[model samples]
Target: MKRRKRKRYVSTDIRKSENGATFLSILITFVIVMITLPLLVYLLTYVQPVKHNNELSVNQFFIFLRNDVLTSEQVYTDDDNKMYFLLPTDEVAHIEQYQNVIRRQVNGRGHEIYLRDIDSFTLQPISFGTQVTIVTKEGREYEKKIAHYE
Candidate 1:
């Protein structure tokens, strides 16, 4: 009878190297940040809050104008600096920009200042709508158009 010797196995390597997933995660994060940073800076510098006499800003005024035009039955521009909207209730509402103020008259309930600190403004008739251009005292310009009879 012959006796065979068994071989013993010894473990030596213990330290683990970085996996491909770790490198992939860092690469993905870097790409996302690179794309987002430029857009964030552009929006922060381009969109700014307006200086106002009270709570209203030029942004809010445009929102109101947009709502008015969307809900109105007809829109008309008188001369150069005046525009009117005929609402669903048959109420004639008007907006006038004179001097350095923008005024809104709702359903003949008298007029109120929509915004101030304006340098100049123009209300004109376009091919399909009325266009409003407002230049504030700070040299910031805001333009909006309201489509008529929509």
Candidate 2:
């Protein structure tokens, strides 16, 4: 009887394929994460953050003053009825009071009650506040939320 020759089988390179897939997956995920991080941070800050001076209400200002932040100075009200409260530092407090104000060129305009004076404010770091400035579709400026010092 004649004997048949044995056949040999060759192994496939499966490791290369697996490594390529792993690398690709990791790269794609990293890119996606990096892109989303900044957007998320921007949204959070835009929705809320610390200190908004552009537009503040009298009630809000009063709240800060009541906290013993503003001394007898660092405040001014313009002649046209614009109230200016500037706390330069621990040493300089400027206060002013005015009335019948129109639009203040220096600080912009709304109503007119200028209160101006110079005094000293105690320098104490209270809790921080978050300010949000967002532009509306109609081109109006609105304060979203008043963050309190907690």
Root-mean-square deviation of every model: 10.8, 15.2
lDDT of 1 by residue, 22-116 (tens): 87798999999999999999989988776564335887888888887888888777775777888778789998875688888887577688888
Off by over 4 Å in 2: 1-21, 49-150
Clashes of 1: 0
Best model number under lDDT: 1
Highest TM-score scorer: 1
lDDT of 1: 0.80
Error of 2 at 11 (Å): 24
**Tens digits of per-residue lDDT for model 2, 1-150:** 999987664665566344355777899999999999999998888685655342344344345444423333344333432234444443432223332111222333343332122121112222453232333223344433333322
Off by over 4 Å in 1: 1-56, 107-109
* Cα-based TM-score, every candidate: 0.57, 0.21
lDDT for 82 in candidate 2 is: 29
